[model samples]
Target: MAPEVRTNVNLKPYRQALALPGLRPLLLVSVLARIPFTATSLALTFYVLLELERGYGAAGLVGAAMTVGAALGAPLLGRLVDRYGLRPVLALTTVAEAVFWSTAAVLPYPVLVGAAFLGGLLNLPLFSVIRQSIAAMAPPDQRRPAYALDSMSVELSFMIGPALAVALATSFSPHLTLYAVGAGIVGSGITLFLLNPPTRGSDEPTGPVGPPSRRAWLTPRLFGVLAVSTACTLVLGGTDVSVVAALRDGGEVRWTGLVLTVWAVASLVGGFAYGALTRPVPPWVLLAGLSLTTIPIGLGGGTWWLLCLALVPAGLLCAPTIAATADTVSRLAPVGARGEAMGLHGSAITVGVALGAPLAGAVIDHTVAGWGFAVTGLIGLLVALAVLPTELRRRRIAADHAAAERAAPEQTAGDDRKQSPTVGGPNGELVGTEH
Candidate 1:
């Protein structure tokens, strides 16, 4: 009597992801986390400009305050996750966020900055925990797709949050909008607390991750990844500066917000599209492609026409590059230390962001106007080329290892049959063992 039996093959994947008891909860929790975190990029600049009587120059301070807190938080949180399970620590974070945001909402200017800094301290760890949760719960093949979908979700959130925040803060009170953002953050932190994600860390772990995590920044591969990711950030940062300056030079400074929003929106679409690829490309290929595409971003001068299209490629590049990085981190993580790994990965990103704007600004100050874009694009291209051979080797190694694992069981069974005691003459051991 259930409405005409429908054999629906399309529901297979949805069914599977849904079948994961915790996925929906995690997704819901993630939505809550994203709204406020992204709102910072969207609203704070306006808050400073409009309410605090600060000019555009204050934007840098706001960004720096948040990021420096986050940079310091990353390692601390990663260490926490390594010591305690993700649940307890994440719960504490949510409570901290609730307190910080609520107090910041009513605080004075100096107090507000302090709150923002503390919020940053509490913020960056959320995403890393979420990443670790996905790795813990998802099967091998689904892990990449899950990460892809998460990236897409964040992209979509960014596209929406910034544009909407700018509009709402302008139309209404900036304080009102920021308060709303604070509420959104608290809600997400609570959600994460409730949905205790699957744990990869064991009670009796194999590695040395229990009490105090070792000073692992000395590891070579970790350093290498940071270098690569940091380079990518510099390219993006430079591109941001170049476009902003070019727009000002062309007397289209007002369009800066609009152009950036458009770029974020395009990236939202591209990330979703990238996630949908049937046979997902390896991270290296996507990385190289993403790096090369920076050419358009750097080259698109303030010609009104190029503004619309130049950033599309850059936006499009965002999700794929991140998705690839997520994959690489997953593969690189130790069995029980994914949370720490993700946090470290996040810190690298923060380092990149912190380094990027200044690097671009310096290049622009001393050089030709157009050199900003050209230099950034060239740097990206060179990085792509320099890393290609290493990436190729890594991929080859991964493939070979995968092949060996797939063949191991069959090979083991065959060997067992040959060496196992046989019943050739009713004395099972004599024929094969000769004992």
Candidate 2:
């Protein structure tokens, strides 16, 4: 006789998710891998500024090249992963990362910018891969917690990676810092290549099945989720620039890291709590909350501590919103097309970040730094409002379709009862249907 398998009502969602086979290692590797990935942006910015003796504008250009390349490449790389297997795509990207980072320091400015673009084009699809794996590994019920965990990992990486990069770059030779960053990235890529986690669920087809047409899966609802995904990040990216501007204006620029760390901690806490909830919140609702919370942050920009305090509400919504978006995309996309869908999700993030900083910067340039927060938050709010109606309509349609499906079988049985005549016995008791 087997022992009773009792369910614990008090068991947390994270624990339940981690109990799944292979999830723990996958998430662990992802967090470790993302640290270097997060570090690259800041490291590159410093190298351009300190080593090349270039202006911020030149550094921005290099960063823009990489961002654009990443935005354009994400879907293409995901499609490659879908067409080819994960290992081949990983191998190709790993080699590309190795080559670019290894030679980046020695390249001239023009060459460096071009190389950066190419490097981004072939950049490892780590973000997409991890999300795809989570979707594949975790059942639908378990995905929210898994994605929440992933978002928290992201917050953790952001919290550590840039600060570490800044410390190394400022304290040591920028050249050596670049070398160290390159080494970390290469090492991460190799580790992922070895791990090679599943990108499709066991029930999903693993053999050669041509991916479905975009029209099949790229429904209006999915597009709305993607739009929300973009808006969510736009708010975040804008807030980052706005925070810096606000700090600088208040003559508290030196404490920027501390304030940002506070904001990240709030997000981390939010993600953890959201995962434990028995019911899931829609991404649009979370996005709206995030945007609304963000709009009022400018009111507290007078001091670094005040700014940190102001950021808490918005930060609290951040990881939850991000996790919700990832979960929604996994649900909406077909299993075969999940890789590309996740890639598009990454692209949306890149686009949002690219747009946010400049938009916020422009607002700051024209007005007070506090207004930058207000404007970006307003934009995010507007986007949320725009998408809400469409999302509702889609849900209504889906509900109606489901109701119709449910009613069909019952209606057919009723019609059959009406059409058939029953034979009666002498005592007026029903015996059988007419033959």
Candidate 3:
């Protein structure tokens, strides 16, 4: 008999992914956990600027310290999760976060910078953990929608978290605001510790199978995905700075929040639609489209609303591109090393954001704000172009290797048959003798 075909024709993709056990709670907790994580940077900036009475340059330095620490620490933390399991790593990071946030409000400038770096080193690996959990909870076929939902939740968090942080900082003392943000971060960590979502899928072994070496899973294809991820965030980060600069130049800086809100909403809508697609879109294609669309945004810098409208195309690609990258990483990484892979993905994101703001700021300093968009978009497009050939070559090699492997078995069977002696029976039936 032929194999049976099972189809979920009536179920929506998001619904199907959500229907899986543990996924809903996991996603909910992830969103909640990420809100404080998102707020930390803004809150720290406010504290440095308002409470410490420092210049923007000093604030930028503090932020840079944290960014550098996170970039360096993410992969190491991920490796720890892979080896020691989730709870221990979470606990350790949680304690570290608690210590930093509790004392951050009182530290001197130099001390705070060092503390920020240390705090970032042990920063709760919320992004990686959430992604790793999604990969664990959702099957390969269902992962796109799951990751899409994850991306949307991230957008939602960013929309809410920084705004809330800013509000508290403005309304209350920056010192009090820092305490509240700290409380939120510590709370998120504690919650994650208690929840302890699975990092490996059901099909994947629970116990240590001994993770493969880095070279085994970190292929050129994986690097390409990471590069695309970095490029995507670089564009986003530059766009952020450019938007503010453009608005300030137009004397409509007050409308900055509205424009950004529109952009975020567009991304949410795009993520929703992308999740429902029957087939996956490649990350490279999405990145290229994002870059292409982003390049024209500067043309609309004449007005805030025009900029908002111009941002729609690139915004639409944001969540989908991110979701696609996460999905690709999950597919590429070995189960044993997925935590590390996701961590590296997080590092790529951090590096991109770190680079984007400065690069865009430098451009906006020397040239017009509009050129910020043009230059950043051009860089992203160039990167996408550069990575395309490598990705294609990798796919071709993988295909050839798969085909050769498939052919080997058939070839061996044919050789065995040919080597066997054949005889004609009395009834004219042919019989083959085994060697």
In model 1, which runs have C-alpha deviations exceeding 4 angstroms?
Answer: 1-19, 55-59, 105-115, 201-219, 253-258, 278-284, 365-370, 385-435
lDDT: worst 10-residue window of model 2: 6-15
Candidate 2 local lDDT, 1-435, one digit each (tens): 999998755347888999988999999998888988888888899999999999999999999998999988998988888878799989999899989999999999999999999999998999998999999999999999999999999998888788889889989977888888888888988998888899889888895568889999998778878888898899999999999998888889999989999999999999988998899998889988999999999998659989988999999999999999999999988887898999999999889888989999998899988888888888888888988899889879899999999999999998787665777789999876643
Looking at model 1, which ten-residue stretch has the lowest summed lDDT?
201-210
By descending TM-score, how would the candidates be arranged? 2, 3, 1
In order, what lDDT does every prediction score? 0.68, 0.90, 0.91
Please name the candidate that would achieve the greatest TM-score relative to the true structure: 2
> Could you give me the TM-score of model 3 versus the true structure?
0.92
Local lDDT at 97 for model 2: 90
Off by over 4 Å in 3: 1-11, 398-435
The regions of model 2 sitting more than 4 angstroms off are 1-11, 416-435
What is the per-residue lDDT of model 3 for residues 1-435, given as tens digits with 9 covering 90 to 100? 999998654348888999998999988998887888788888989999988899999999999999999998999999999988999999999899889989998889999999999988998999999999999999999999999999999999999999999999999878988889889888988988888899998888886667789999998889989999999999999999999999999999999999999999999989988898899998988999999999889999759999999999999999999999999999999998999999999999999999988899999999999888888898889988988998789779899999999999999999887776789988999988777
Query: With candidate 3 superimposed using the best TM-score fit, by how many Å does residue 107's alpha carbon deviate from the native?
Result: 1.1
What would the TM-scores of all predictions be? 0.77, 0.93, 0.92
lDDT digits (tens) for residues 179-266 of candidate 1: 7777877777666666667656233363345543435433445545655665666666677787777787778888887887777677
